[model samples]
Target: MSVTDTEATGRAPGGGAGPEPAVLTRRLRLVLVLLLTTQFMLAVDFAILNVALPVIGRGLGFPLAHLQWIGTSFALCAAGFTLLFGRVADLFGRRRLFLGGLVVLGVSSLVGGLAQSPGMLIVARVCQGLATAAVTPAALSLMTTSFPEGPLRRKALGLNGALMSSGFTTGAVLGGVLTDLLSWRWAFFINVPVALAVLVIAPRVIEESRPEKRPELDVPGAVSVTLGLLAVVFGLTQAGEQGWSSPGALLSLVAGVVLLVVFYFVERKVAAPLVPLGVLGKRSVAWGNVAGLFAFATFTSLVFPLTLYLQDVLGFSALVAGLSLGFLGLGTVTGGVTASRVIGRFGTRTTLLLGGSLQAVFTAALVCLGADRSWMWLMLFAGFAGGIGNMLAIVGFMVTATSGLADHEQGLATGLATMTQQVGITLGTPVMSAAATTAMTGSGAVAVLGGLKGAIGVNAALVLLGVLSSALFLRDDRPAALRASRRSGHGRSARRKGGGRFRPVA
Candidate 1:
């Protein structure tokens, strides 16, 4: 049977819904491309403006302190609303939310590109974040639902992971190129075209999906969780830029923690909780998210200190410093593409162990860096190797995290994973930056070098902890869903049997 025909009929080659055919049809291939492209766009946007922050600030006449809002505004909104949007997609429709997010992204990017004032630009960024928050979970949930759990799904996710990592690497380069050649505004303008294109094509290619029976929206739970997340993320940003003891950081942290505590109680009492907290009890889901958090924390945090080593200590230009990251990017792409094969051969636990161990080793090796320019070769090698290991672990974490749930829970699963990832990314920079700052005891390149080494050491320590945790906790590779399906005789029956655990409220 043709792949497109199988997909169109919503059946396997043997006929009538069961496991998906273990082949990639042209139509399904197209869908994968479309979804993967969406993933790449989101990842790219995360880093695209980072390089252009200075240019954006000067163009909009932003005060030096306020310039951070360019990035923070987007991060805060995206991280805060991700969980809520993920569940919303499950209850409403993934395709609908995905398309809406694209429209919002395009419009916001256009406004950002045309902004005449810092406030206008910041507002646009906030909108852009909200758009991202919507699209990321929706697109990911769609990907999970579109491909059944098998090699095809593994391959798709590997590519998804690849695109995500590569997109970030590519964004830094593209941002630098666009900012230097055309304008910093091009970073925002660039997303407009991609968003517009995706908006036009996605409807034709993607299937619309939502739960069969919808539940009333969880308003109080959503508000509490969203506000809590926003406060925590804002506090982390503040703590990184200012000291942890700074009033802004301390107050935000305290408030966020309190709100989160309230959310926990609210979830327990609510008839229809936004997130079924029980999902966290699953070993794969809980441990997988922890793996994801550390993977991002280590990988993302390393860039900052490395940049300092390259530019401040070694006296490389900003462009050169950015370009130097190509080594790591190349490694990331290479790792992402090959991850599925490794997982398919070794299974998730082994893959996680291998990836984490390598990442920790390479991250620790970064201590070799100093004022000497000749050490660039070692740095490049370490970065490239580290990228491969990090992506492998990341893909494994994602695969593990989403493996056990019923269809209805996939959205929540992906949302949880994505949320942890954002949190990790947010936490890494500040923690590493603080470590670097604290370790600096002297002046000039020597002091900067000492700080960089200290940060790397701290990150290496964190990665080692991740490696240990995975070794201890990630004991199985078999998915709970597959086992349940085996016992029930079909995927649908398994879901039906298990669905009662999270029944919707009237």
Candidate 2:
């Protein structure tokens, strides 16, 4: 068998002793559950704190202005350290790093739950962010490695995407309920048990993965990229609060851009760059990330305005508002499960276009929202539609990004895919909030409604741009030989199974 055949069949090159098919299948299922649960926990953390922010501020004596830092600190560290840790995981050991990350996340959540001062909570959040940076890529790499790129991989990724989306929405709901019933601290405490369970179970189920040839760390590349991302996330956070033209935002953004450029140059010169320039050359890696960025930016941003509309205009309590979004969460689940089949039938590109279009249309429907009670059902319908479309786009983008990469390179690909997603999530709300804030005409609820409509319109437009990028630039660029080998493997597998095969690219 050729190298391609070994990969396509998910078997040893020489038919050496391996686990029985039934045993292997069961193990894969266990691994998927473990990884997907972790993904959900991390995703929940992203939004859980947001709903509890005001309460936390009051409890910790945080000033109104500094409250955003509680969230920003996590985003900053998570985005900054993600790529470096991604490479570290690939070189060191994925399972080892994954376990370490879970420990960090648990400890941080404990500290956060027990925090007495604003500074302490903020510090804990930063640690949690760092933990997330470590866990996400490592977990993603594990999934890609455990499941060969075919129906199984697509199905795993689809569920991963669904849980990720739903988890964030679910976090909003849980945040409200936990805060109202127990305390805001429970929001932080909830993660501890989940992390502990995973830590105990993960080592037994997940085998470690590392590159066959370990290279020396690219210390310079790591420092530059990490700092550059930090600066960028800081600048974006500042832009959301202060105007983009403010001196601090301006300086941070410029410094970030320059540092990123420097990192690019460093990569070109280094023997073993943290992110190999060659990986970026793949069409899937480049364009797929672009699609992922927009998919997240629009979908995540839409939530902010919707939350505001519910609380400010519709006179809903935070808990009520969060509960109402149950429809949105359900839609994401539906879309995520449906995407794998869609990809198998129409391919990732078509899925991308279809998802983006539907997302835009649903988002645009929000423009009709009003202060009347009649608008509630429309809001739910639009949220459901938007959620479905958003998940489909995200899953398609991830599948596209990770496809056509070698097992060793899966870490880098997932890291890049995940980094873009974090950046998009970080970017979306601030930009949309800034736009809405600027469009606000007065201090009344009416003014807020107008601003929200404008933001939703901007959200629709951004998603449309994502669709255009997909239509114009995205294409399957896998090597012909690799593609041929995959087709042959699929043919044999399908024949043996009597007819179920998944083809995700044209």
Candidate 3:
């Protein structure tokens, strides 16, 4: 009875009157399938470039110094616009933006594949990131809006989180195969067919929805936050390449901090802010983001250094190194399939603790890795452990962070969720690199091996800090009301029927 405008109108059956519950449920499942497929393409887009970079540089004839732009350009644009576009989806229309983004992504992919020069390729990649920024939050908002808060949403999110994780590792292997077998251009061009399929199917499957009372755009908040995020991402990327103490990195970092502080004040004054300061004040959202930040940072930090160790220290080829990480993809898929069940039985917080604990253990285990140690253990089992841990942790973070918000603010919630991930990844590698470099032991292979151990140790510590924060600050994953319902049911069958409920916010 107290359902909001969106629940009442936007969620109305289909075009006719209203479909039966059975029919509606089926429709929702199809929608979920479409959304997850799109997510896979987006997530893989990032990783697919990794193994193809050298070929891309040669094809485009760019100087070695500028080759990084193929990837960095995408990161810069994605981190810059993700939040701003989140608000735009809420204000304009999520379905429209989501579709537009797919088109943009498709177009950019085509352009990139066909590009003849470095500048053209970089421009196309930047467009791909910009489109991804729009697509990510809009897609998440659509999923949250489509399902009620219960087993349904939990399962949906868990599966999505898994696919995203698996997509990354899978893309690494995919890129290598595509590059060696066909051409590097296929890495960019592959998105075209998938995007086209989603583009064709999405309109029929997904229903359009947006906030109830449209508000004016918060220009001040938007500009400040976007620039702040952009500066921060650029600074972190610079630090990864040029060291944190460099003048450019330091200046960008300083500017980003100043802009963000200004944005905070501006958001308070704005009639309709880009990000409500109040939403961020909530315990679950705030600490969930903190957890999400470390979850992403720690997992991503392992890839580059480990790649070096495999290829340089242990004498693996590029293709072998890339394929070895396939264990991570398997773990991610397995974790996704099981995370919702784990949450259903144990609870979100417990699952989160378990996940964080797993990640910490995985990274610490890597510290024992040596040149003589069988690559099979580290590359296969350890990679799988790390993959599952990161995926589970990510799903937990997303569920907790966005749980209590009103439907209208789901965009902002998803935006912040995406933003934390991007920022975490931006900061993760550089900080870990610094920690490892400070303790460098010897030269070439030996030095690289020793440095990686230190770096992985730092990663373990960061994840442990995340575990501490989750245990200390996050509100219980299940509300008192939901627990009461489950208690009343009191059986294996009833427990499966136990639906999630909410308590009043403090």
Best by lDDT: 2
**Model 3, span 1-506: residue lDDT tens:** 12332333234533222322322355676788989999888889878988888888887788999887888899998888999998899898888999999999999999999999998999899999999999999999888877755567778899998888778777888999999999999998899999999898888767777755789999989999999989999999899888989999999999999999999999899878888889999988899999999998888777877887788888889888887777777887888888888877767787788898998888788888888647558657877887788778888888888887877888889989988887887788899889779768768878888888888888899999999999999766665656776687644455455554433349
Q: Candidate 3's error at 407, in angstroms?
A: 1.1
Which portions of model 1 show Cα errors greater than 4 Å?
Answer: 1-17, 478-506
Clashes of each: 0, 0, 0
Model 2 Cα lDDT, one tens digit per residue, 368-479:
9998768999999989988899999999999999998887788888889889989999899988998798788988899999999989999999999999999999984444
Q: What TM-score does each of the candidates earn?
A: 0.92, 0.91, 0.91
Q: Candidate 2: misplaced stretches above 4 Å?
A: 1-9, 13-24, 476-506
**After superposition, candidate 3 runs with Cα above 4 Å error:** 1-24, 373-375, 479-506
Per-residue CA lDDT of model 1 for 353-450, tens digit only, reads 89998999999999988688989998999999999999899999989999868777888898888899889989999999999999999899999999
RMSD of 2: 5.5
Q: Model 2, residue 93: displacement in angstroms? A: 0.9
Q: Could you tell which candidate, 1 or 3, scores higher by lDDT?
A: 1
- lDDT scores in order: 0.87, 0.88, 0.84
What range of 10 consecutive residues in model 2 has the weakest lDDT sum?
A: 1-10
